[model samples]
Target: MPAVVETYQKIKDLRDKDKHEKQKDYQSAVETFEEQAGALYEKLREKEQAVEQFNDTLSHGSVQAHAFVQHRQYIEHLDSALDDLQPSVQQARLKMEHARHVLTDAYVEVKKYEKLIDMKEEEHMQWMKHEEHRHMDELSMNQYMKFFNR
Candidate 1:
């Protein structure tokens, strides 16, 4: 029938849509990672330039007791920033991995649930078959009684 065909087509279309959406999400995550990496690299270059500037300044000046203190402090700040950046970038990558893990877990769960449903349905069908046979036996007995009375 046309209705049956239409329903099948709709189911297929919905599955296709879901597949496309998942692909889009994967592409978007990759783009985000690339953009973050590029920005981090640019910031690293800028930070390096700051260190170079500080070193050049120190070279030009006569060494003073306080000058080393300031130089050390500047380098410390740079090191701390880099340290912080590492954890942040790592966290993002970890999030991506976690998302993948969650999807895998869901897939595994779906298979288990599907198997459970099939088992339940099979049991239900057996029960229905037994009930139908019982009813048919009762019907046959009632018909025999009616024929004898006639």
Candidate 2:
């Protein structure tokens, strides 16, 4: 194969590898979304349970001091967890968005690379023809040199 053809093939192979890495990162973003959403959902459930338990204790006409104390602590925990989750959810959303963008860009890049490879292959064919012409000229030169020597 000509040098140009070889270089084009090598470039195409590297593009494939890059595409694979992007896909892996996109997969990881999906997993992160799942993890963030799952944890947030569980925390919301805990918050609801805390509020209900606290209301029930009050309605019974007794302080239930120990239960109230524990419920209050749980409420605080739920609030704090929710606060932390907000920023992480936003970050995950951005990561997913960027991953999607990269995937789209990769698709476009594949087309561009295909065009480039085709062009390079055609140019290589032209180069091969030139090389063949040079080789024939060398053969004639060798014959002339032999005649002169004789």
Candidate 3:
């Protein structure tokens, strides 16, 4: 192969490796985001359940004022924590999407280089075949001339 084609092949190899790494990063990011979202939802559910239980208690009988205030405060705290966690989950999702884009670009680059290398190799093979045929024709012509002269 020509040096230029070899160089392209090397570049393609590097891009392929980069694509692999990007895929792994994307997978990890997705997993992290999923875990974060799951935890957030679980906490939200717990908070909801707690509020429902508190309401049921109030409906059933008379409750103390301090206990009511404390339950409200606990619910508020859970709400605050959920609010804080939402942004981090969004950030993780964004990171995963970005990684996916990078992986896609790397895959395209590798394919482009692969096509270029294939074209170059095909051209080299055709040129070699043409040269071999020309050489054979020349040898045939020489033999014909020798037989005619004799």
Candidate 4:
């Protein structure tokens, strides 16, 4: 029974480790998405600032028409890049959710194994108690018989 409990404990430990790894994977996915999204936002901010600056210069009659065209083109390119990254961000979020589900399943598995071990340990304790009672009864009966024979 102890051996059985031990085996279950080992199984639970393995499940726990697997769950931890899955959690790490989920966290990593989240971090990666955050990094990507942050970078895109930063780029968008820079582009917006550049556009504003260019507009200010144009208003002051200090910028060339060709330079304004180039800046507009760059802003359009940034917008397209942001559009491309939206899908990637969604995919990363989905991946993280999947990993979270996997981790939850692993946690459930570990709990199940631990519960089995606990049940087995309780059974062992009951069995030991029953055996001890039987042993005491036998000893008492032996003494009674000896006393009667005397």
Candidate 5:
């Protein structure tokens, strides 16, 4: 409960709050990236399935020529779109990783501040105990002198 310990406690509280906010941000980033990747994969699967079904229909030998070309072009467009999305997904993953690192650093800072506060409190407690014992000794010596003199 010394002034120094109080200051350290205040710092620790601020650091802990910062750490909590960073943790939340990291978790949100992770969830966002995961959802994006999952949706992308699902879309890729659907596109691949569509292309396969179109190929199967072509083998039936009753499709119109224009419809065939249009289907092929649409599949090519889907491929290009998927390719374009991949870099954005990669960027999201990188952003999530950065958030995780920032959260970790914030947590470390909080712990260090907490440790410092604990050490300061311990030192203060020890000093208080030493002062109390010295005061008690002084009182006891005064009483002993008074009793002998009387």
Candidate 6:
């Protein structure tokens, strides 16, 4: 029983380590997703600022045909860039979700191992108590026989 308990303790330790590693992986995934989202937001902001600047310039005077064409092209380009970024952002979010699920599984596994260890320890304690009671009974019997024979 002791050996079995020791083996279970080792397994519990390994599970704990695995849980920590999974937690780290989930945290890294979260950070990566945040960074990607931040970058995409910054890019969109820059594009908006550029559009605002172009509109300001246009308002200051009569717009030339070439400037109108340039503005249309920039808008088209911004639209395409946003379209491209949307998929990447979605992919990052999915990865973060997957990492979260994996972390949850790892945590459950660690808890299961911990529960097993607790049960085994409880069993071991009960066995020890039973053995101690048996020893006391034997000592009492020996003393009784000694007194009777004397």
Which has the greatest lDDT?
Answer: 3
Q: Write the per-residue lDDT of candidate 6 for residues 64-140, one digit (tens) a residue.
A: 89988988898888878888888888898999999999989988988888898889899999999999999999999
Error of 4 at 44 (Å): 3.1
Candidate 2 per-residue lDDT, tens place, 75-116, comes to 998899999998898899799889979977876776687888
Model 5, range 25-136, lDDT digits (tens) per residue? 9999999899879878977997989888988897877898899889988888888878887887898899899999999899899989988888888888899999999999
Give the Cα lDDT of each candidate.
Answer: 0.68, 0.85, 0.92, 0.87, 0.89, 0.89
Those runs of model 4 whose alpha carbons end farther than 4 Å from true positions after fitting are: 51-68
Give me the overall lDDT of model 1: 0.68
Which of the numbered candidates is closest to the native, going by highest TM-score?
6
Q: What shift in Å separates residue 46 of candidate 6 from its native position after superposition?
A: 1.5
TM-scores for every predicted model? 0.47, 0.62, 0.82, 0.78, 0.80, 0.83
Better of 3 and 6 by lDDT: 3
Superior candidate under TM-score, 4 versus 6: 6
Error in Å for residue 143 of model 2: 33
lDDT of the structure predicted as candidate 4: 0.87
The alpha-carbon lDDT assigned to residue 139 of candidate 3 equals 99
Q: Of the pair 1 and 3, which is ahead by lDDT?
A: 3
Tell me the RMSD of model 6 versus the true structure: 2.3
Error of 3 at 85 (Å): 0.5
Mark the regions of model 3 whose C-alpha exceeds 4 Å error after superposition: 55-64
- Look at candidate 4 and give me any clashing residue pairs: none
Across 1-150, the per-residue lDDT of candidate 4 in tens digits comes to 689898888889999999889889888988987887787788779878988888788788876779978988988998888888778878877887888788889889988998899899999999999999999999999999999999
lDDT, model 5: 0.89
**Per-residue error (Å), model 3, residue 12:** 1.4
Q: In terms of TM-score, which candidate is stronger, 1 or 6? A: 6
TM-score of structure candidate 4: 0.78
